[model samples]
Target chain A: MTTYNLALIGFGGVNRALAELIRDEPQRFSSLGFELRVVAITDLAFGSLVQGDGIDLAAVLAMPRGSSFDGLPGGSSDPRNEEVIKNSPADIVVEATFTSPVDGEPAVSHVRWAIESGKHVVTTNKGPVALQGTSLSKLAAGNGVRFEYEGAVMSGTPVIRLAHKMLGGLELNAVQGILNGTSNYVLGRMEAGLRLDEAIAEAQNLGYAEADPTADIGGSDVRLKVAILANELLGATIHPSDVHTTGIQDITSDDVAQALANGLRWKLIGEARRESDGRIVASVQPIALEADHPLAGISGATNAVSFTTDLLGAVTVSGPGAGRVETAYALISDIIAVDDFVKGAVRA
Target chain B: MTTYNLALIGFGGVNRALAELIRDEPQRFSSLGFELRVVAITDLAFGSLVQGDGIDLAAVLAMPRGSSFDGLPGGSSDPRNEEVIKNSPADIVVEATFTSPVDGEPAVSHVRWAIESGKHVVTTNKGPVALQGTSLSKLAAGNGVRFEYEGAVMSGTPVIRLAHKMLGGLELNAVQGILNGTSNYVLGRMEAGLRLDEAIAEAQNLGYAEADPTADIGGSDVRLKVAILANELLGATIHPSDVHTTGIQDITSDDVAQALANGLRWKLIGEARRESDGRIVASVQPIALEADHPLAGISGATNAVSFTTDLLGAVTVSGPGAGRVETAYALISDIIAVDDFVKGAVRA
Candidate 1:
């Protein structure tokens, strides 16, 4: 049995949920033909801890909210993310930091450090993937490591990996998706006679929206996801700024009602297509789709991506766009990818 | 470069379309890091032809419908399917024969012969996969080969493989799909104010339904697919007769109008779910789905499968259920599976 040692970069919700799964479910990993052991952990609030063999996950998870890892072996009050990442005896680094949309800081550097140190990376952050995906991917490949971020685009819905692995050999002309769950849920509530502000409040109360809801509602978050999908899947060299973005802020309750009266649904759609002139155009905007449209039925906090291929026509996949455990599954998927690559490389 | 020699059984629409792709597109194969060569072809109408150096697909594809392979070198008037499948210098057998609803005859035999000969098999026929999948898979595994049937459920839509490869590690509880496109098309037409017969005629006119159309409209087609999906994905040892089957024939135009008025759509749904006591329940019925259901938005000839999982929620995938080029692409996908298996096994 192949056991992989992991360095968890952030003690956030996503990583915590993953640790819980690893501790609770041994059969899941055994079924996938591998075992996972957390060797190092770094956090902004909880501080840092490193155990070369394996860390006691239950103890760490049971710690109080404001407590630090000061009494633990090899523990420090400071995160020391870079030092822990570069020198940890871990085959893979699990990065689940905050998305710095501007420059994709910290997370990108964390990914780079792990890659440069020849450790594979699995991240749930959109920042590093959307902004620095190409160079980071090249760097990892050049170093015989894998840089995987399946959670960036649709948060464990398998959008990026689906296009990369499942839908191979087909000419994928375009990809359009309902990428954001907050906006989608808000739109659904708007159709049910709620105003934008009311819907947003409901979303926040339901834990779908963050305290700073500007990114989710303003389309910038989707912009980063679109940039990642375009660059990684469509072979386009694009930054987040390149996507022309507009959110559902303008689609009012009256607009939603009118569209519903006319058998249309308002949705925030992020799209990227290869044009005839050999340019890949990426955008995020609100569109009124008919009842039969692939993305129209995606209500509530569900997300979907419809790939327009030359052969398969419009193939769509819809699932949860956000959740701690759901997003954590993306990391598990990425680790599976890492395991496959390493096993294949052993023969190579 | 890896070149896989193929024996195409039943050079019908699907195999011919695959031949056309191999003839027209070289870049597609080059991109996948492999080359495909058809070394043997057997058709009930055109007889059998085997050339160890690879046959001219263009000439064979261009041949008239009534023509036999008699005039060509290494050709016979009789199909000689067993001999061609066994004796040909082919690494994989591509089976695209007519599906047998009752016994899964000739196609099952073809798959068996190919597997017993220590050759990988990729088939688009539902008969073999639905009826004899477990035994054939065991035989192939014991013989150090593979038996893949991605096209059997939903032609070229990637349903089986998507669940097999992409959704690994998740606990899949149930799988439900709009497996039969003809029934779906007919129901959609009925929703547009057409009678069942009229809607079926429209489907036939659009080439979505066959002349008989009994298997499609009577829910037998969905039963086989459900059996295959239940047996394959959910790890159930069940036959096609186990499914409680119903069709869209009883759904009248009035029913369609009533459902539409109430914000629902009639769909022929095939489902297999693991019950609490560990028994698998499979059914095919005309379900009046709310607009937000995962399989509701699938229109016309498009097919979809919604997998209920522990982590990802209801992950749904939709695409074209049937087409010449599309079903042919399923063969390509299965061949890729074969390639991956062979490469992996070499190291094992």
Candidate 2:
């Protein structure tokens, strides 16, 4: 079997989910000639751990949920002290660190290190791709490695591959869709008669929204996603601040009821269109969409992106926008893309 | 330039559209290192022509619509009554012939010859793939060539690639979608208060429906497309007869009107699901979709397919189901696939 040494940059919920999915489907990966070996794991709170060859995944699963592996077998000698960048023997790095759209430095640093060290990088952090895609792409190009982040935008949906690879020849006209699942879920709840705080509380209870939830409900997360898409689709260098932003925080229950009465639905939409002058005009705003519009029916935590192209016309992809297993699927899909690229099956 | 020596099986509407799309943008194909050389064209009504090296696409575009190339420069010296297949010199065969689902023998014969001669084959003929995908795939595999018909299903939409290639690793549970464009257009028109015949007449006038229109409104067309999708998605042989057939023909304007009044839309949906017994079950019928359903809002000639998989969860792709440019885009996408396969970039 082709064993790949994997490094976990952060042992977050998504990384743990990836471990579970791979564990559950051992036969499938074995059939594909893949033997995933978790050689190291690194996190700020948990510090870093590097086993000589690989750690026992089965034993890791038996540990208590949300518990760090500082005292487990093959655990690092010094807990809360070692730097991840200085120590790790992995060919595939899974970067699931916290993202800050204000400055995508942490994720960017890990990506740069992975590419420069001739290791493939698969990330769910939108910050790196949104802010440093061009430079990271250049770094990967220079090092003959891959930088894939299918999880960064639409969870498990094939949006990045559809835009960057499948529709390679066509010139994209516009990309518009619901990019923030938390805001969408909150708005859907509000439309269903819940207050904003009530909906956010419910989302947090379901683990779909963060404790703060400002980045998601405020549409800043969607702005960052749109920035990534715009750079990839329109070849534009757009920052999150460059986009005109709006949030669902102001969407009252009355507004939702009014939209329903008008045979419409309210959604926090992130749209980026290439204007006639070749400048990319983008925004994340709450729009009253007709019930018949594609985006209007996307309820709950689902995410959908509609792409308008010169050749293939309008193509929309929708799926789970965020979840541990779904995001892990995206990370795995990104890894598979890198594998295909390494095998010379897909062009980068 | 990677010049492909191509012979036209039929100089029909789709062939003309593809020629025009290629003529309009030479740079698009040029960037991909493909120079499509239409060396010969054959049609029963329009006769046959053979230009030894290649035909000038620009000069051919100057001819009147539907006019034959009888007196063009370096045209066929052979009589118009003779078959061009016996005299044509080309490495690839493009079969855009009229579909005859009852037999599919004509296109199958041409496809066989192309494969036997080590020539790549690209077609818009649904009959062949529905009736003989297994045989053709085997033949193409044996000959080390390609057999692609992306336009056989959803025009320009990347359904085949999504099913057969991109999501190859996942175990697909179901493939459901609005597959027929003509029926969809007619149903949309009926929902807008037109009678069935009136809507069909409008569709015919707009070049969306064929002269007979029974193949579309009768749901046979959708059955064939579903069979193609099922074969790819399930990796099991499915005949067109295996599909549980129903059509929009019995759906009156009253039904559409009532559905609209009830906040629903009538769509001729084709659904294929894997049974617990491991058998594939499929149906083509007019289903009343709720306003919140993704397929409910898909109006006109648009098509959308939702794939439920073991890994990626649910993903939907919606796009132009049928159009001259759109269908031509499907053909070009197939060409690129074949090119990649030939260049050892993709696994067959």
Q: Provide the lowest-lDDT 10-residue window in model 1 chain B.
A: B339-348
Question: B1-348 in candidate 2: lDDT tens per residue?
Answer: 678777877776788888887778878888777878788877655456678787776776676656666676645434342245444677677888878787686888888878877778898889899999888989998999899988888877888887665564577988889998889889988877899999999999999899999989999999998888888777769889989999888998888899889978889989888988998888898999986665776767778898988876777888888776787777888888878887778842
lDDT of 1 by residue, A199-242 (tens): 99999999999987888899998999899878877899999999
CA RMSD for every model? 1.7, 2.7
The residue ranges of model 1 lying beyond 4 angstroms of the native Cα positions read: A345-348, B345-348
Model 2 stretches astray by more than 4 angstroms:
A44-46, A65-68, A71-73, A77-86, A190-206, A257-264, A290-292, B65-67, B71-87, B189-198, B252-264, B290-292
Candidate 2 vs. truth: CA RMSD?
2.7
Compute the TM-score of each model's chain A versus the native chain A and list the values. 0.98, 0.92
Question: For model 2, how does the per-residue alpha-carbon lDDT over A152-220 read when each residue is reduced to its tens digit?
Answer: 998877888877656756778899989988898899889879999999999999988988999988889
The stretch of ten residues in a row with the least summed lDDT in candidate 2 chain A is A77-86
lDDT of each: 0.91, 0.81
